[model samples]
Target: MMKVLLTGGAGYIGSHVAVSLAAAGHDIVCFDNLSNSRAAVIEHVEAITGQPVPLVVGDIRDRDAVRGAITDHGANAVIHFAGLKAVGESVADPMKYYDNNVRGTLSLIEAMVDCDVRTLVFSSSATVYGEPQYLPLDEAHPTAVTNPYGRTKLMIEEMLSDIAAADPAWRIAVLRYFNPVGAHDSGLIGEDPNGVPNNLMPFISRVAAGRLPELAVFGDDYATPDGTGVRDYIHVDDLAEGHVAALDRIRAQDDALSVWNLGTGQGYSVLDMISAFERINNVRVPHRVGPRRPGDVASCYASPDRARDELGWEAKRDLDAMCASTWRFERTAAMRNA
Candidate 1:
């Protein structure tokens, strides 16, 4: 029965993790700036959990606001997810990523320290591994980030490590995620990005829903079987549960800092994902193959063995489940908006 504060609780992954945490009998407070998300997400989460979650409309870069949220709710732990995401955006404006992802994390931790809430589960990305040196990237893989987005994540990881080393009282778990797709089974809450989505799954969903014209298959000439970039697309629900699992482990153990990769340990090319979505949902997704984007990798997946062994968590949903749920949510959202 931990009282947790989710920094970006109204966002896609944060909302799902909020539901998961509530189901696990934990109280949660969502602190978000609503920059890339909507306030209606808090209502949607309430609908899913049948429990009220406090929404604090604030930025993580504001230490006073963060501290107030933690102190006001008496939160015992923090799941830091308030940060800008999107590789192209990060590259176009590297300063924004540094200010939000890196500086925002520093501010959040400072607030946590002030509030004496040391347990944290950070949302990191596998992009830190960069262009994979080996297949099934493990935690020990050398981090040579290729883009500003990846650099921000790696910088935060290093910062957290240094912090935990300086103060053993701080318990932190960094989960490096692969691609997270799909939606909740209820179809009530899913990835609803503003404007053009930067990720593959949401972009595909929009294209299938007729909101977008076609999906751009970036880098079809990559050195893969299908000549497209391959990624490990874990279901969003599974990723949410992984956060809960990491939270549980950090709370139970005295380990100052722990890092785990949250992924399916399997690779799916861009074509493979498109084909799966079409086959599973019986829908056509119009797509066009364009030249490879800069800083794109040929293949990237995860080992996921550390999370399995340490946290006893593994992605359970299959590719079909991911596609079906995503399509279901897309249709449901379209109808509701109409």
Candidate 2:
């Protein structure tokens, strides 16, 4: 098992991945700024894993802090997940995305180079593919991102590619996720974004829980089965397991840089998701159709052939599980807050 340093371990996906990594017997140290996360997530992760997860409260943009975390923990590999992820927010504040996502990644890379931590698993998004030229986007799809959020992810991908080409010692795996939803089966940790959420599952959960007045169904004019946007929503736990597989794959290789899409290889429209959630949980998620959000596409899913053939990983959770786990976590979180 690898001694890994998780850059955004207190956040949604990072925390889940932390549990998965621990289950795989890897030691972890979480380095987070607590910007988009809370300290209590570390405790939840520990409770689920029954292991102590050391947390280093520091910004990824701070090279010294990052290096110190690595050396202090004797981490040989890094899972980079700390970044601003809201697409609309990125469009509204391009500079913030650039500074936080792009610059922060650069600092992390430099620290890794200085410390000789060559193995890295980067958290990327499907937005880097831009508006799909075809259904089920593959890694070979042309990359022309439409928003600053995608641009930042693509920039980091290019940077990693360059670094890998320059030095053969770096073993980097870029897992471009489609859409992550749901929670851990334990319901001890889940996607609990700060303030207003930028993702769909949380919005639906809030609407169902009466925390939000209504869900904003962004655009019904898209050329899809239901006149709504379609995406491949893989459960967050499955996404987390994919990271563990990626880390294992890269470590076995002498030197490598690879990209894989972590998705379920199935598409679900917005309406379809709402229907499934309501049917599974017996709850009404009130929603209203609005104009399409900027940087959104008509249809975007993943082929998942590469990830399956290469990493031996595929998302296994069904839509019912996604909806059920989300509602379970929502109720659990509500009780905790109460």
Candidate RMSDs in order:
0.8, 0.7
**Position 285, candidate 2: lDDT:** 93
lDDT of 1 by residue, 54-144 (tens): 9999999999999999998999999988888888888889999999999999999999999888999999999999988899899999999
Clashing pairs in model 1? none
**lDDT score for residue 5 of model 1:** 95
State candidate 2's TM-score: 0.99
lDDT of 2: 0.95
| Candidate 2 local Cα displacement, residue 133, angstroms | 1.0
Q: lDDT of model 1 at residue 190? A: 92
Give all candidates' CA lDDT scores: 0.93, 0.95
